[model samples]
Target: MVTSLLTFLSLTAFPPAGDHYSSTDSGRVRLASELAWESGRLSGNQYALLTNSSSQRLFNLADSLIKTERAAVFFSPEHGFGTNLPDGVHSTDEQYKGRPVVSLYGNKKKPLTSDFGVADTLLIDIQEVGLRWYTYLSTIRYCLESAAMAGIPVIILDRPNPLGGLISEGPIPDSTLMSFVGALPVPVRYGLTVGELFTMAQHQNWFPLMKDLKLTVIRMDGWKRSMLWPSTGLDWIPPSPNLPTFQSLYWYSGTCLFEGTNLSEGRGTDLPFRWTGAPWLNPADSILFNQSGIRVQYDEKTPVSIPGRAHKPKYENERLPGFTMKSITGDRSVLQSIRQVILSLQSAGRPLTIKPYLFQLLGSRSVEETEEEMKALNDFRIESRLYHFYP
Candidate 1:
């Protein structure tokens, strides 16, 4: 059945529209939130905003709505309104500029009809890191479900996928593995902007409420599928507290898998997701690199308790020998390198244990099997392209 779907997609998929950078000017990319506010799209409606600190760097959508009396209640995703809270930390309801700020993380992942208060619309403007495991995608899905249930429309202020929209990696997750981290069946690097992703979901019937949900995506002006964060001419705002730099986000696709393992995935350190190490990790086992354009260096680092970032991270206060990875060409898959690292550690007589959380992160039990499934996702990729707003 899957083979037939792939073959059909291969025959009917839309042809490439050529490279966006070749024809269009790659100046400062204008955000959809700024465009919506400048125009009358964000006016007159008492809307609730699902946003974080990342959305405020260019234009403060929350502030603009509040000042105009269009904001009814404020909603925050995984990291709270400020985006300063640590991972897994529960965000409480609070007051933001005299407005009720409700957290979409923690106990309540979705909003109730009453949570909307006197709002008629829901405005979402959070910046996404272009990975499935990032909780923002799940939050967006929940918001859509809630909006559909409440009969309110959702206006998504689109942002650029920091990793660009070209290369997708890893497997389309199994349905049984659906969680907050792996909400939908998209690959690890799904390669779609948040708006594009939700649009694909709604069109493809990924969720039941998607068909009933009224969604309006305010598209960006100059973003291209080929342009990464650096190419977009926008400042790097840490979507989360740990991903402070573009370099950290670059290697996050693979290194984020370290979070499920026994090793410290660079949490509580200066560079999270870019560094992975443990006390048991042998220095000799670190010589593992199968993927080209990836450089690894051996280093020693200790995880410490940084308030609001990584409070009591794994292996905290313990100096461990580990390697830091740097991408030379920025196109190679770090997933292969990390997989090889796991194999090498096991080969060197290290008692490495794979946890159940690893399956949740990878969306499958075996990395090799997931890679095989990823190869057969031509149909899914082509179907995704049908909803692409940009070239």
Candidate 2:
């Protein structure tokens, strides 16, 4: 018997013993912190950590080896160490779990020697949602460059990209479009794991100071290019406040584009990125979006389905007619969702302006405004020629 592509992609259940291991089962892929402790590598090493609440277990594993949670201090990214802050709301320094956590958002987008205190190594294990502008990637680059200045090594305990490490999509970001949202230009749905990305950056000399920085990535085991979240057999940890489920995360690439426009993006609703409707659009008439795979549904295709909180979604009490998203191919097809929504808005004469922010939200990558949507992205010279790490 032969298997289908969908069958291979939808291989969700745990594999048998001694085969492909997962943290859920065989635990083949160990966290860098965990591996360090087991190999007696943490001894006599003064290392600072760059982590958040979702990935705190890595820190804890390290602490168990060192016998003290007392680091000189800890470094935190966007949502703070506790992962409790709302989007765009600046977080102040706070003592979390007995260690001072420094904010890495707003003007302080990168790390400094001061943030590291007396430590000489940095451990990064933030669960990135695999989007170019998710900011974790930027945070990693900053840490790399700062580690170079601080003369330290960065050990990345890589996490599985929710969208998997195959099938790169969307356009390569223009150099002019660089921001905290996008440190280096890659596809919006880049296919590399965080560690793989770091390796590429280091080899590409993207970070001049850290081009030769001593970097190590503790990679996952049993993961493949085409596998999505379910195939990993790992649980979901919300990378940000807005994205609460695999469904929400899958729909994020598409719905996130709405942030650039005036549309509500289902902010206040329970399905932040999953369902979108604006006051001007009517639900019954289907004012826009007639793409083959585009859809509006309560349950979306994913390894799992989870309902998240939307305290004050856009058009709260008023009726806003919009569409829900689906993952005809893993939710990574966010560009499709985005392209359709833009067409819908254009058809409705909603004045979808291409402000600088619109491009920024799209990670500065070029998207066609006309009906001919992008099926394949324009490959970058750096990506195709020099920086690629995958086979």
Candidate 3:
């Protein structure tokens, strides 16, 4: 099969188009759309799909590009191929569209020598949840390393940050605790697309051995740094199971901290990150909780929601109501506010525990573990800069 496909490519002629391209009024172009149509990087076996909404864009482009005798491959991240797997599920090798579909999550987070031998160049198009802990971001870094090792060029088709590029939050991850979640010193809400992230990653010199890395980014035309996912005018496909709506991710950067606790983090419920709690939480008592100093650090609003109506009372209300968040003026203030709440809750013997440890979420205990570090955590939000894609 490989021999036959290789022969077809050897005899074909693919023309290169101009740098910029546009979409028609009614049509939605996928990430693979631009690169697939033109000839430069199509010769090698093509591969993509490691994160949320990434496969949608990749497959759309692959179907558009794959023609007579053209062979393309698609891969998946922490979730299995097609992202049918729930969060924390491992990926298994599979086949779809008559092409090889490999797993980039779980056992094979990083690419081995064999993956590169299958394709000459690789293309990455994933929808990241914008939080640092999400595995999708780590998958991208691993791909960069693999492509570098194999001497293959990687093209990233960027997408918008759902949290909006206007604001960034969180602290600089200590180098010692760097993991897939904290790939670099980036803030929790690093407001850049996968393409922009590639550029930043390069500048940060995180992968120094990947010196020969060949990368080209197909930047979005209609996107602006300030625009959130909804403003992009692109279809809203759930990038991950939990990120069902833009609102989910909008509140995730801070709310995700709940993951370290015994709290629900709203996973079993419909709202996931947006509606977080354990049975012990009294919506009435906790109503003004977020308004406090430490709680405010994690939530931008003085009051994250109205008390009794917080959960939307699964048995009664069907529609999820939202409350206005208090405008947070500074990151340090936000952190201070959140710490106050957490400590208060703990002292009150609230079911919440420090076990999951806030430090685990940051991928470091350095800043969150100590009073001085927590002070630094509050200041991390102020340092984050919004990314601008174009002039």
Candidate 4:
């Protein structure tokens, strides 16, 4: 299927997947922004926009219908517009696509009433990489909260969750450990897309201000419940500095837990999460973890790559033997990966102490080998499927 960034959403609907999708089954979805504009929804109504660099292609295509004058101001999440900023840094306010861009990740994490100015609606056109730990979901919540307080309507131009709406992983975090990263009570890899999440949030009234707040989600044309990231026909733009490829995004589910440990998550290298190691790890250790259903091979040669914002990646330039992660399919569950990592750490090397922060990362107990912990993992997988907004 030849999918262009500017293509209008198809009017056609597809049937459920058979053994696999045929040429007759296609979901050439239009961006919600396009539907809104073409349908004259945003023709004259002023709005406040929450978007970033990734959506520029859509913005350019729909520019005739969506002018800067229609937006009172613009908002951006982490990594700045189009990932122009480095990881972990703040985005600065600037003019983008003709409107004044406000830094939601910088001085103000939430939009204030003053930020809305004269806008009556909040248009969300951002792309989400589909992890609760990722910051875009937090930005959406803040935008919704501020819009609710100001009594503004929010129209979400829904995008694919990239992970699709099927498989979810890890346990949900209890209220105590919740922060900017794990802001929601969902599992580490919650399956719902941004639009579905808002629907659930409003139905459950997750926020006090949104009880009567107006919410409209423009669903996509052809997207189905079962398609994975690669199936979408969209290019894999790096959602963040660390996850530069679809391969990296897939590997991230399990590998990201390395952040909680003392190991280097391949930050300085071109392949961040995919290349994990520490100066303490042994090359022979990769063989021990190979039995855990993940291929972990020690690299003897250095890979060429661009660095993120970090100038000094941990273990930079040193040929410390580290393992390369190779799980890029949802066929494998995250808890399975976590279990493998824990068992590998115990058997492959001397026992190590995990930091408390891991609880926040995995949204469950630290990677301990226990029956109760295992039950939590199973319960998370079974319970989270209830939140699937698609299919």
Best by TM-score: 1
Off by over 4 Å in 2: 1-32, 57-59, 62-66, 284-287, 297-319, 327-332, 351-354, 369-391
Position 259, candidate 2: lDDT? 70
How would you encode candidate 2's per-residue C-alpha lDDT over 98-213 as one tens digit per residue?
A: 66777787558777787888787787767888888787778888888888888898777666788876666665555677887778767777777787777666654566887668
Pairs that collide in candidate 2 are 267-313, 268-312, 268-313, 268-314, 269-313, 277-322
Which stretch of 10 consecutive residues in model 3 shows the poorest summed lDDT? 294-303
Q: What is the C-alpha RMSD of each candidate to the true structure, in Å?
A: 4.4, 8.3, 9.9, 7.6
Q: What does the lDDT come to for candidate 4? A: 0.69
State in Å the error of residue 380, model 4.
7.0
Model 4 ranges with Cα > 4 A deviation: 1-27, 58-68, 300-311, 328-331, 351-353, 369-389
TM-score, per-candidate, Cα-based: 0.91, 0.80, 0.75, 0.84
How many backbone clashes does every candidate have?
Answer: 0, 6, 14, 3
Q: Would you list the C-alpha lDDT of every candidate in the order shown? A: 0.80, 0.63, 0.57, 0.69
Per-residue lDDT value at 38 in model 4: 54
Q: Residue 329, candidate 3: how far off, in angstroms?
A: 11
Q: Per-residue alpha-carbon lDDT of model 3 for 54-146, expressed as tens digits?
A: 356534555543453344566578766676666666767777667666688767778775765456667776777666777788888888888
Please, what are the lDDT tens digits per residue for candidate 1 over residues 211-310? 8787777788788999999999889989899889999988887888777778788998877988778887655654553333457777889999998899
Q: How accurate is candidate 1 locally (lDDT)?
A: 0.80
Candidate 4 per-residue lDDT over residues 82-103, each given as its tens digit: 5766667887888765667788
